[model samples]
Target: MIISQQLDTKTDHQVQAIPLDSIAQAQGTNIPFEVCVDHANFVRPNPQKHVNRLRSDNHYQGLSSQEILNLPPWKDDFFYFSYYAGLNGTGFMGFEAGLWSLSNSQSKSHDKCVDKFIENHRQDQRNPMTQLWIFNHKLKQIQWKNNKYIFILEYRGKGFQVINYRKTAWDLAQDQTVWFEFVDTKGNRLGGCTEGWTCPIRKK
Candidate 1:
């Protein structure tokens, strides 16, 4: 059961359950989460393509942090969200600083898990999703992560806005199987989710 669903920023939270067997097939093999991130990044390069840029050229090398900051290139909205290396941070290492769009922001629940996973790397038990993040769109919020924190930036949308996000964790793994549920802020189950899934938080 392979689960293939899009997490569009426009869609409200909804758990669209698909068969585990199907998800496995679509995923090809039951690859570790880290491997999945590497492969996805390799194939797609930048999932968040519209809002970010990648700078790997040598002309940008040896500039001090201040000089790098002062460059006109840094002012571009796309530049702000994208990642750059020291004229040497090519490939994966260079683009690790991901910029979040609505889709990734909406997945903050998962981000908490991701933050923990990244930290766990020091403990030698890594969570694999950290590498899969890309800066597809510019976010209005302030995104920052330090050694122990994953901060959700603030953003303004139509009439509603996001001020900040605190780390929250949900247990989706049970009895060797993972469980997922999604609901709007009002607790309404979104019906268009993939098939065979149930929204655990839905209003009855």
Candidate 2:
């Protein structure tokens, strides 16, 4: 799903795993979540009451996580709704650039629009919400633009990230589908990919 257009001056965004502090510290604000849980807990017959915090946060992101994954709230997951001030207006991470690679669980990353960011709570390796995502598009959050990274995403463990070009961050009218996070109904979005409550959507 990674769009490999002719790399030119038009595309200046670099995919560097830099520290989130230097780029967004001055402008972007990282609003920490009061309640966070693993993606595994959100399964059917929810485990804890605190799970709602996770469910609702994802639901608030335009579309609920369970719904996004095609898992209805009744069977595949629980039903919940919530509001978090920290997640206000955080839009899609479909920065409009991506390279869909292959992984095990979901599907053929290449054929489908998914990144292979895997996780295992049982294993020491976990996919914590890395600032690398928000950092990659630091300019979006800092500049005095209406569409910028208002809030960071609430990803729990590491998973594959598609190639992010970040062109849409500058031009909203552009074809957002070029980005790997593009959902058929929601356009380019990363909100449903996680437990939500935060994403890099467009807003003033």
Candidate 3:
């Protein structure tokens, strides 16, 4: 999906469309869940108890590991929500268990919304939240001005982690198009596509 943001330029604010692919490419392999999980494990040996409590919660009972990993499309909301729990320092298993609970708790309409949002972006990835997890990690700052057309994002970090961006990033590269600006966290224009850029968006 193209993320449009209202950037504060030298003269004034300009609306820019940041293709999601560009952002993914900039952030190489800094996967949030992997990092968060490792941090949690090193900080606490018995992190499983929290995970167990999450599993016992109404949202996540009787789910297999595979089920959590391969959550249904309708459960996308829960999947993304679990990222925050991980961001708050939950381990990989803790995140998975929380996701399992959330997936079971959401209604049909919520799942339909998830499906529609993905289709609207023409995003082909079966699990969009995986990419979102990465996006959330690099997203240093973001805000929506008046509407969707006006957005601002301050991304930090490098290298592509999401495979879904391959085709789009390739198309941009082959055509030699400059879709967005690559800047530091301070909003300095480093260059266009010559370098790399990152964009983060909330699923609507």
The lDDT for every candidate, in the order shown, is 0.25, 0.24, 0.28
Model 3 C-alpha lDDT per residue in residues 1-204, reported as the tens digit of each score: 111112222221112223333222232222222111101101111235434543564555776544544433212211122122222332343343232222221212223333434463465443333222222223333222221111122332211111112222232345443233334456554333221222322332
Model 2 residue 18 lDDT?
25
- Candidate 1 to truth, TM: 0.22
Off by over 4 Å in 2: 1-3, 10-194, 197-204
Lowest summed lDDT across 10 adjacent residues in model 3 is found at 36-45
Count residue pairs with overlapping backbones in model 2.
18
Q: How far is 155's C-alpha from truth in model 3 (Å)?
A: 9.7
Candidate 3 CA-lDDT value: 0.28
lDDT of 1 by residue, 1-204 (tens): 111123434433323222112111111122122211111111212322312233232443555545544443222111110111222332222222222222344435334434443444445321112222222121222212121111121212111111112211121121232222232334343222211111111122
Best model per TM-score: 3
Residue-by-residue lDDT tens digits, candidate 2, 86-182: 2122112221111111122212322232222112112312222221222122212212123333222333222222222112223334433211121
Ranking by lDDT: 3, 1, 2
| lDDT score at residue 155, model 2, on the 0-100 scale | 34
Instruction: Please give the range of 10 consecutive residues that has the lowest summed lDDT in model 2.
Output: 76-85
